[model samples]
Target chain A: MKTDEKTRAPVARIPDADVPGTVERMRKGERRAIASVITELERLSAAAPALLRSLQPHLGHALVVGFTGPPGAGKSTLVNAIIAQLRQQGRTVGVIAVDPSSPVSGGAILGDRIRMTAALDDDGVFVRSLASRGYLGGLSPAAVRIIDALDGAGYDVVLLETVGTGQNEIDVAEVADIRVVIAAPGLGDDIQAMKSGLLEIADVIVVNKADRPGAEQTLQQLVGALSIRATMSDKVPVLKTSAINGEGVPKLIETLDQLGGKVRAEDAVSRRRRRARYLIARAASDIVANRIKAGSKGGLDTLADSVLSGTMSPHAAATRLLED
Target chain B: MKTDEKTRAPVARIPDADVPGTVERMRKGERRAIASVITELERLSAAAPALLRSLQPHLGHALVVGFTGPPGAGKSTLVNAIIAQLRQQGRTVGVIAVDPSSPVSGGAILGDRIRMTAALDDDGVFVRSLASRGYLGGLSPAAVRIIDALDGAGYDVVLLETVGTGQNEIDVAEVADIRVVIAAPGLGDDIQAMKSGLLEIADVIVVNKADRPGAEQTLQQLVGALSIRATMSDKVPVLKTSAINGEGVPKLIETLDQLGGKVRAEDAVSRRRRRARYLIARAASDIVANRIKAGSKGGLDTLADSVLSGTMSPHAAATRLLED
Candidate 1:
C-alpha cells in the first residue's frame, strides 16, 4: 500500500479562516474535514481554490478505480463486495458514488447508500454519495475536486461508482486510473452495454451476477465484441463475478491489483496528463458558462438577440463568442 | 404550417463559392441538396459557415420536436408512427436520430435505421441517423446545422429522437420546441425515466408500448409522478401510446402540435435566444477543446506537467488555462 508521509503531520491552527485547519484535519484523515471540503468545492465558493491549493501536495497517492454500468447491473453490490475484500486486506478506501438526481424522485441516492452499508462501520472505509445535479455521464463537475480531497486524505484506493446510461457518462474514463464496466445477464444488458458505448472505455469488463442464467452467453458476447478491437495495444480482460455471494470477488481484486501496479508503472504520467487535460477543459467550460450566465457585456444574451432577429447566423454568433 | 417567403426567391448564383447555389437548391426542397449540406456541415468544412449563412433567411419554419427515452423503450417505433401520422396530414417531415456510437459494435445506428424504415420510401419524409461521435448530450455539434438546413428546406416538422440514458442528454431540451419523453412498461422504465431526470424537461410524457402487461401501472406511476410536480406552471400531459399498432399516436401528434404552437406563440423569441446561447457555448467549448488538442504554446501540456509534478494544483492550473 502507498502511504503519504504527510499523513502523520500534526493538525495546525490557523487564524481568521478555518480552511487551513480544515486542510490539516483532512490530511490527518479526518472524515468530517474531507466531507466539508467536498461540500465547499461543490458549492464552488471563493474559499475552494485556497482549500484545494493547500491540499495539493498531499494529492495523487490514491489509485482511482471506476466502476460503471447500467443502473440495474449490480454495480453497487459489486462495489460493496470489493470494499469488503479491500477492507479485509487492511487497505483504506474512499468511495464516491455518483447518482443521477431526479426532479421528482430524489431518493435513489439514499437507496444506494443503504445498499452499500456493509463498510459503513469500518473506519478504513469512507463513502460519499454525490448527486450529479443533472451534469450526467459518470461524475459531476465537483467530482474531480472531491476525488482530490479523498486522495489527499491518504486513502490507498478511491472507488468511483457511476451509473452508465448514455455515452456522456464516459467522464469516469478521465478520472479513473482503472475503468471497470459491469453488466448483468437477462436484462438485455449486453445490448445496453453496447448502446452506452462503455465497451470502448473499459479497462476491465465484469459480468456481475455470474451465477444467473445466460451469464456465460453475455460474457462470451463481450469477449467476442472486444476481440474485434484486439488490434488495439491493450487487451482488456473480461471477468465474471457473482457479487451477491462473493464469488469471483477475490480474483477480481487480484486482477485489479495487478492491473493497478502495471498501469502505475507504465502509464502513470500519461494518465495524470489526461486527467489534467480534462480538468483544464472542464474549468474552461465552467468559466464560459458562468460568463454567459452572468450576462457580461457582449455575452450570450447579446449574441442570442442578434441570432434571434436574423441579424446573424448562429454559427457566426458562436464564432463571435469564441473570439471574445 | 409555417413557410419562409425566402424559399420562393430565385437561386442566386455567386461567382466564387457554389455554397449559395447549394443553399438555393436546398431551399427548393431538393433532397439531394439537403443531404449534401448536412454532410458538409457534419464534416465541419470551411464552406459550412457560408452555407449556413445563405440558409438563415429561409430558416425558422419547422417545429423541432425532441423524443427521448432509454434505449429499447421503442423510441424509434414511436417516432416512425409519429412520422406516418404527420405525412398523412400532408406535412413534410425530417427526422434526426442520434445514436450512441460504440467503437466496437457500431451497429446501433444501423438498427435504428432499420426500425424507422416505414417512412423511407415516402418523399414527404426524410430520416437521418447521426452518430453522436462520442459527444454526449443534446445533438451532435453538426445536428444544429442540419436542423437549420431542414428548416430552411421547408420541412413542416423536424423530429429529433435521442436515446436518453443519463441526465446530460437533456441537451435536447434546449434544441426542441416540444420535448416528449417516452417510457415503456415492464422494464423498470418508470424508475429509469425518473432517474434520467427527463420529467423536468418534458413537455409531453409518453408511455409507449401501452399494450404491454404492466402498461396501466406504468402509466399510473408516471401520472402520480407528474401530479406531484403539478405545482409547476407548465402542466405536462402524461399520455399512453401503443406505437406498434398506431394506437394513440394521433392524439400524441395532436398534443405535440398544440404544445408546439403554444410554445412558439408564447416564447418563440426566448426559445430562439436560448438556442443561440447553446450554439455559442458549444462553439466556444469546441474551440477550447481544439486549442488543447493542438497543444498551443503555454497550453494544456505545460500546465499538466506542472500539476503532475505537484508544482501546481489541478484547480489552479484549470484557473490559469481559463484566464488564458
Candidate 2:
C-alpha cells in the first residue's frame, strides 16, 4: 500500500500558505524548524493542522518503537543503550518520554531529560519530555502529531517511553510499530505483569537488570506466563538484559531490528491502518469534548444545579446537553 | 441550595411509565431490584436512561467515599474495616471495587469479592466489582450511573475503591465526596505518595499497616510532605491504622463520620453541584464518542486506509470525520 512516486510528487510542492515553507525546511532536516513545528503541535496552535497536512507525504518513514514498564525499571538506561546502537548504524533517532503524573514544572521531566545526556550531544539524536496537561494517559494528546512531524523530518526511528501503570498507558501499543514491555527482578510477584495487563500487549518482553539474583527466575516466570496464552503467529520472545553493565543490549537491538523488519515486510499496511484508525478516533473524541466544553456557556452549571436540587436527573441533563 | 419540601413533592410520584415500578422497588430496598438496575446500567442497556430519570429524585442521599492508593497498600483491608464500622453504626453501604487490568472474568475480581465476604453476608451491604472493560481508568464508564442507582436504592453510603496508579484513576476524586488516600509502611521510598499523585487529592491520608517498623518514619514523612502544600480551610488529616488487627479502625471511622458530617452540614449543595457537573461532562464525552463510532460506517475505514497509505494525514482524516 505504499504510495507511488507519482502520488508522492504532489507533496513535494505543497502550496499551503501556512505550511509549505516550514515543511520544506523540516524535510531538509532543519532542526529548528522541526522543533518549532513540534512546539506548535504541542500547543495545538491553529497552524498545526495545515502543517501536518503539508507534511503528510513525507511521513511514515520512521519506525516508532514503544518502551513501557513499571517505574524504576531502568528503561532510561536501556533506551540510551539502544540509541547508541542505532547511532552506530548511522540512524537518526527521536525520543518522546511521557510522564503522566508530572505537573508542567515537575522535576521529573527535567530529570528524565538530563538522564538522556548520552544522546543530547549527538546531532543525530533528539529528545523531548512530555507531561500530561491533565490528560489521562501518560502521553500528551498531540503525541501522534509530534511523531508524524518527526517521521516527516527524516528521523529514522522514534522511541516512545511511558510509565506502564494504567489502562490508558496501554494505548502506546496502538501507536508504536514495535512494543517492548520491560520488567525488573524483585519488582513484585510474578502476577505483577498479568495484573498490570502488560503481558497481553507486549511484542517483546525484556527482563532488565538481569544481573540481579531473581532475574533468571523472573524471566522463566514471564516465559511460562506467555506460553499459557494462545500462541500468536509471531512468538513473543522474553529476553534478559542488564542495562547497568550493558550486557545483552546488542542482542536486544538485533532482535528489535529483525522484528521491525518482519513487521515492515509482512504487516505494515494492516498495522498502519490500525494506528490510523485509533488516532482518528481519539482525535474525534477530543474535538467533540472540546466543542461541548466550549458550548456549555453556564448551561452546564444550571443543569447541574437542577440535578442537585432534584428537579432534573444527571442523565436527562446530559441528554439535553447532547441534544443542544 | 437545598430544595424545600414543596419543591420535592412532585418527585414522590415520577410518572415515567418506563421506570416507576423498578424505581419504586429499589427505593423499597429490594436487593434484587437494585442488583438488576445496576446490571442494566453496567451493560449500558436501553432502559438505563429511563431508570435513571426515575431514580433521580431519590439520588443525592448517599455519601460517596473514595479510597485509592497504590497496589499492595492494604486498601481493600482498610475498606473492609470501614464497612464494618459503618455497618455497626446501622448505615447501609454499597461498595464498588474497581480493577483496571482485570478481564471480565479475571481472578482479581473474584479475589476482591472473596475478601469482602464479611460484607457480602450481611443484608446491609451490597458489593459490586467493576473491571475497566478497557476503559483507561480502573472505573467503568457506567460507574457514575451505578453510583446514582445505588444512591437511589436507599444506601446510606457508597464506597469507591480503586488503585491509584495513573492520572486517569484520579477521576475518582470527582465522583467521591470524601477521598481517602492510603499508604503503607515499607511500600517504597518516601516519594511514593508524591509519585502516585495521591497527596494532592487526599482529604484523609491513612497510613495502613502501622505496626510495621518503618510506620513512624513513613507517617512523619507524609506529614512533612503535606506541610509543604498550602493549607486549605480544613486541614487534611493523616491517620495511622493497622487494618490487620483492627487497630485504629474505630478512630478512623470517627474521623470519617466527623468529616462527612462537616461536608454535609457546610457545603452539601456545592459539592453535589460539582459532582453533577463532572458526571454530565463525562457522560457527554461518552455519548459523543459513541455517536462518532456509530456514525462512521465504512467511511472511517476508508479514511484510515488513506492515512496509512500516505494519501492523507491523520489530522486531516480526523478533521474530515469531525466535519461529517
Candidate 3:
C-alpha cells in the first residue's frame, strides 16, 4: 500500500469479472484497488452488493474507532497525531471523516477533511471524506460499506472522525468499537453540546489542545460530567493532548491500544451482525419513506388522510402499512 | 389568553372527555390550554390522536416561517426582534425552537430557547423547545405535533428557529411556509456551512448582527453566492439586520409578509398532507428500526445472515421483508 506509480493513469472501466479482482487486491492491501471499491460504493453502483459479498470473509478484522466533537476542538489535529503514532507502531490506519453536511452548514467539514488528508503522505494511511448531506437517516450507505472495504483491505485500524454533535454523527459513531469525544480548552459552548447527549456515548474523552489555558478545567468538567452518568463513567477515560506539539498523545494511543485489546473474536462477529442489521433497517426506512412520499400507491394517501384527520394514530397507520 | 390567573393551580389530571375540552380551549387561543395540549404531545400521550383530530379543522390559518443558522448568528436575538415587530403589527406569533441536541452539544440550544421565551411576556406570543437528540431520523414527532397545536391555537404566524445545520433541523425547517436562513458578518466558517446547501433552500436570507464589522462584505459575499445559484438567486433576498437596534427588521417583516402572502389555501392543504406523510414515515421508520434491532422475528435472522454473508443486498432484503 505504498506510493502508487499509476498516479497519472487514465481511468478505465472494469469488466464485471475484474470487479471481483479489485476486491481481491483491496483485501491484499493495494491502495488503488481499495479506492476502486470505495468509488463503486459511492456511485451506488450495481457492483456494491457483490463487492461487499466478496468482502464478507475479510470483515471485522480491524479495530474501528470513532472520534467526534464540536468544531474548533482541534479534532483534525488530534486525529493526525493519532495517525502518526499508529504509523510509527507499524499499523495501517484507515480514516473515514463523516461530514455532517446539513443544508445550512454543508461544506465546512469538507475543507477540514481535505486538509487532514493532504497532510498525510504515508501509503499506509488511507483517508476518505463521506458527505452525509441529503441523507434522511443515520449513517449513509457508503459509510457502512466503505468501513467494510477498509477493514477487508487488511488495515490494522480504522478511524472515523465526525465534527459535530449531530444525530447523524451519533448513529455513525456508535458503529465503532471505541468512541472518542474531544474538546478544546475554554470552548465552553462546545462543551454544552456534549453535556446533554454526546458525553453519554463517549468511550474516551480527550481534552485536545491541552496547552491552552483551562485545559485542566475542561478535563475536570468532562470527568465531572462522566461521573454523573450511571454506566460509562468508570469505563471511560479522559486524557489531555496538545496535538500541535504531540504532547500527551502517547498516553492517548496507549489508552487506545488497551481499549483495542479488549475486543475479542466473539465481539467481532456481533459487530458485523449489528452492522448488517443497521444496513437492513436503514434500507427498510428508505423503502417505507419512498412509498409514503410517492402516494402513488392506492392505500397510502388514505392512511395519510387518516393521520391528518387524527382518526388514526401514526403508529397504527404505520403498522397497517407495514403489515398489510 | 393573556395574564393567566390559574398559573398557580396544581397539576390536575384531565378526564378523557375533558382532554377534548383542553383542545377546544387551545383552538380558542387560551394560553394554558395550548400549553396543556403541547405537554400532552410531549408526553406522547394516548390522547394525542384525538387532540390532533380535534385540531384538524383549525389547521393552516397561520403563516409558518422557519429561521436557522449556525450558533452565534444571533438567531435568538433576531427572532426576538421579529417577535416584537410581529406583536406590534397585531399579529399573534408562535415560536418553535428546534434544538438539534447532539450528545456533545445538547443543552446549549435549550438555554437559548429559555432566554428567548423569558424575554417575551406578551400572551400573544408562545415559544416552545423541541429536543432533536436520540433520533435516528430528521425532525421528531413532538416537533411536528407542536406546530399543529400552535397553528390550531390561532397564531397568525409560527416561527421555527434551529441552532445549527443538522439533518434534523433541515427536516424541521422544511415544514415552514417560508424558510429564512440567517448569518452574521465575518463568520467565515459559518458562511461555509451555508455556501454548500443552505443558500439553495433559503427563501429569505438575513445577515443578522448587521452592526458588526464587515457587514457589507458579508452582504456582498452572500449576494454573490446567491447569484451563482440558478433557481434561488432570483427569488431569495439577502437583507442585513441589526437585530440589536431593530434595523432592517421592518423590511424583513415586509419580506416575510410578501412571501407569506404567496402560500395559498391549496398550498396549505398540500402542506398539511405533507406533514401527515412525514408523521407516517417516521412512525414506520421507528417500527422498522425497533423490529430489526430486537431480532425477535422468526425470519429476520435468516435474512440478516444472508446479508452478512453477502448473498443478498440490504435493499433486496428490505423489499422481501416488507413485501412478504
The most accurate candidate by lDDT is: 3
Reference-based lDDT, residue A224, model 1: 76
Write candidate 2's Cα lDDT for A1-324 as tens digits.
Answer: 222254332232223474778878888877777888787666555455577667767766788899976555677778888888789889999988665545523545445454655454677887776664333433454677678778878899999876435433556766788999888887552234233456656788999989998989888767755656656424888899998788888898888888888777754445556676776666665565566555655887798766544455555777898677
Q: Give per-residue lDDT, candidate 2, residue A232.
A: 40
Best by DockQ: 3
Candidate 2 local lDDT, residue A203: 84
On DockQ, the stronger of 2 and 3 is 3
On a 0 to 100 scale, what is the lDDT of residue A210 in model 2?
96
lDDT of 2 at B32: 80
Task: Assign candidate 2 its CAPRI class.
Answer: incorrect
Task: List model 3 lDDT by residue over A265-323, tens digit each.
Answer: 45666787677777788788778777777756468778877766545667888899888
Instruction: Return the lDDT, model 3, position B218.
Output: 83
DockQ of each: 0.28, 0.22, 0.35
Clashes per prediction? 1, 0, 10
